[model samples]
Target: MNILIFGYGNPGRGDDALGPELVAAIQAENIPGIECQDDMQLQVEHVTDLTGRDAILFIDADASCVAPFHFSEISAEKDDSYTSHAMTPHALLHAFHTVYGKDAPPAFLMRIRGYQFELGEALSSDASENLEAASLFIRNLCKSPYAESWRSLHRG
Candidate 1:
């Protein structure tokens, strides 16, 4: 049941902080079998961090996704962001498979919907509401045994 919850986003930005903020909230719960980590953005080095993990959950802010969040399983598809500073979850998974010589661990992406993303601005009221909803949803997941099984299911 080992699980890694990786959240990334810029906290200084208004709604862009949703990812890291959610990680903070989840860490405060101190739930067993769950390890939460956060960053301003994903990096190539993060690919190695997935080693020995049963499952990984990548969380980020999305301006066009459904309000609150959209959760879906992710696979190790080739991505062109290999040369970019910030890498996508798919890119990270691809790196993991290439470097480790094994299938990447089951992974899921939780794209939290956001409205504002101005630098140095506080979270917007609408973003706050969305954050609350996402927090509750993730909290319930932490308490449920089936939470980790989400990676096994495919939702087109």
Candidate 2:
């Protein structure tokens, strides 16, 4: 199965780099067909990669009032604004489906907190630790084969 992962963040910034850094940490595992990208934010062009993917996941850092390790499963219908948790997942999914035709791949957003995104060159020690945890999760996920849970099937 094709697994498409988009890790969003600003690498130049401090805690903002968490998304991309975590993705990079997902070392070689049995999962061979995984495709991962570190993007500033998703654009409509990304819809092209949604074709025939068993599953897709986006990881980003959010400024939420929660624990440092909180993660959530977001549907395509949710906001997924790539900026704030306030965005609705369903809305974004609908937008993609409208633009790309009603066959956008099944997607989920995993947002992490406890980040202080400063305009700096390095990541904070706390954010670095969280990135490691998130990376390990992705590594294991890619190893597993796709199930019906992640999708309703889309066009290629």
- Top candidate on TM-score is 1
- How far residue 16's Cα lies from its native spot in candidate 1, in Å, is 0.9
**Model 1: per-residue lDDT, tens digit, 15-126?**
8899999999999988898999999988889987798777888889899988877888888877788778888999899999889899877888888889999999888988
lDDT of 1 at 82: 72
Alpha-carbon lDDT of model 2: 0.63
lDDT for 141 (candidate 2): 61
Give one digit per residue, the lDDT tens place, for model 2 in 38-141.
77766655666567777677777766724344444445654456345333334555666777677466676666554677776687777777666666656656
Residue pairs with clashing backbones, model 1: none
Pairs with backbone N, CA or C atoms under 3 Å apart (clashes), candidate 2: 77-89, 77-90, 78-88, 78-89, 78-90, 79-87, 79-88, 79-89
